[model samples]
Target: MASDHVAEFEAHRPRLFAVGYRLLGSAAEAEDLVQETFLRWNDADRDVVRTPAAWLTKVLTNLCLNRLASARSRREDYVGIWLPEPVMTDDSALGPLETAERRESVSLAMLVLMEKLTPVERAVFVLREAFGYRHREIAEILDITESNSQQVLRRAQAHLRERPRFDASGDQRRRIAELFLDAARGGDLPALERLLADDVVSSADGGGVAGAARNAIRGASRVARYFAGLLDVPLPGLELRVVELNGQPGILAVVGDALVSVTVVEVGDERVRRIYNVVNPDKLRFLAAQCGLVARNWRQVIEDTSGSVMELRAARFRE
Candidate 1:
C-alpha cells in the first residue's frame, strides 16, 4: 500500500514542482521543496489523509515559505543581482497554447515582478491565480484565515495590474521570432532593430556561477547594439540554432555540436520587448543531455489544432 501510494505521489511530482517553482521562482528550490514534501508524506500515516495532493501542496508551500524567509536574508548578502533558476523542459509535450501560458508564467520579467510580493502574498497569489485554488484551500495551505488569503490576493493582483500583458497568438509570436532570428542570423541589423521595442531590455542569468552579465542590459538601442556587437565577436564555429524555449522562440548557441546557452526572447505588442539569455550550466542541465535539440513546430502546431484537445491546447497557442 505504501509503495503504491509512493508511486501515486511520484506521478504528480511535475505539477507540484511547477506550483512550487512559480511560487518561489527558483527551479532548484522548487525541486527541493517537492522532495521534502514527499519525504514528509512518506513518513506520515497515509491512511489518515484524505486528499494526498492537497496535503503535499500545503506541506510544500509551508516549506517554501520557510525557504523564502531564509533566501531573502541570504540575498541581502549576495554579491550581485539574483535571478530565478531557469526551467528547461521538453517543449514537444506542450501544444502552442500550453507553451505560451507556461512561458508567460515563467518569464523572467514575471519572476522579477513576483519578487515584489511578500512570501505569503506570493503564496496566496500563486495558489489563487495559477492553480485556481479557492480561498479556503489557500488559507489552509498558509495556515491563515480565509479573509486574509482574499486580502493578500487582492493586493497581489493590484500590484500585477501595472505590468502589461501580451496578446499575440502563439503562431504570431513564433512567426515573429522566426523573422527576428533570420534577421539576426543574416546580420541584418536594420531589420532586427525594427522588430525590437523602442525601450527593450535584456538580461542574462549565468548566476555569477559562470560567465554572464552581472546586471541587466536596458534600453532598445543598447540592446540592439549588444546583439549587433555579438556578430563581431568571433565565435567562428558557433551556430545560432532556433528552438522553442518555455514555449517561445529561443536561440541555442551551438559550438561544434555542443549546446552552450539558450536564450528566450519576449515579444510585446508585436515588438521584441526583452531578451533572457540563460547560460548557467546548472539551469540548462536538462538540455545538456540533448546533443542535437528538438522541439515541436509551435506555429504549425497552433494552426493545425482543430482536434480533440482544443481547450487543453488553447493556452499554449496564444503566445
Candidate 2:
C-alpha cells in the first residue's frame, strides 16, 4: 500500500510542479510546495480520495496562494524591479511547451504581467489558460462558484491584456538574439538601435545585490546605448551563450561555473520590444545548479555554439 501511494504521487509530480511554478514564479518555492503537498498526501485518508491528481493539485495551488500573500509583501519591499525568477525550459520543467500559448503562459513577460493580478484572479487565470481547467473544476478547487471562477478569469485577462505579442518565429527569434549578442559584444550602437522597436524597454532585476539599472530604461535609442555601453565593457572570463529560457530564446551570461545573469527579450514585427535582464544572485542559484549538473564542463558547452540551440538543451535536471 505504501509503494502504491508513492507510485501515484510520482506519476503526478511533474504536473504538480508545473502548476506550482507557474503560480509562484519561483522554482525553489514551487519545489518546496510540491514536497509539502506530498507530506499532506501521505497524511490524508486515501480511501475517500476519489481522484489523486485533483487532490494533489488543489493542495499545491492553495499552498501557492498562501505563499503569494507573503510573496507580494516581500516584492513590495524588494530592491529595484522584481522580475520573476527564470528557469531553463529546454527540459519542460514547467510543463509541455508544444503550443505557443503554453510557451507564453510560462514566459518571463507573462509572468511579470501576472504580478498585477489578485491571488484568486491569478489562480483562476493560470488554471483556465495554462492547464485548461474547466470553470466547474476550477470552482471546486478554489471553493468558488463556477460563474465566479469565469468572472475571475476574465478579470485576470483584463489585467494581463498588455502582455506583448511576439511576431518572430523560433528561428527569427534566435537570429535576432544572435544579432543582438554580436552587436552588444561589439558595442555596435547603430546595429542595436536598428533591431530595437521604437518604444523598446529594458529592465533589470539585481535584487540590490548586483549592479543594475534601478529604473527601467525606455525608448529605442536609450535602450540601445544602454546595452552597447553595458556589454562593451569586457569582463575577463565572462561568457555569453544563447539558450532557451522559459520556452523562448534568451542569453545566459556566465563566468567560469557561476551564472551571472539571464536576458530574455520579447520581439514583435521582427523587432525587439522588451529586454529583461535578471542579475540577482539569489534568482540564479537554481539555474546555475542546473548548469553544473547538466554539463560536465561549462567551457565545452560554451565553446560549441555552431550547432542548433537544441544541441545545448540541458537534460531534465532533477532537484
1-319 per-residue lDDT for model 1 (tens digits): 8789889899778778878888787766787888998889889886777888888888888898998888888877754466665444444321123543455666667777888888998899777766679999998888899999999999998888755466777677778888877776677878888999888878876655556677888876677777765544344355786666654667777655455577777787998987887766666654545435432222222234433334434543664
Instruction: Identify the candidate with maximal TM-score.
Output: 2
Return the lDDT, model 1, position 125: 79
lDDT of 2 by residue, 136-178 (tens): 9999999999999988988998889897576678899989989
The number of the candidate with the highest lDDT is: 2
What do the candidate models score in CA lDDT, each in turn?
A: 0.71, 0.84
Of candidate 1, the 10-residue stretch with the lowest lDDT total is: 294-303
List pairs with backbone clashes in candidate 1: 96-316, 96-317, 97-315, 97-316, 97-317, 98-316, 170-317, 170-319
TM-score of each: 0.82, 0.90
Candidate 2 global CA lDDT score: 0.84
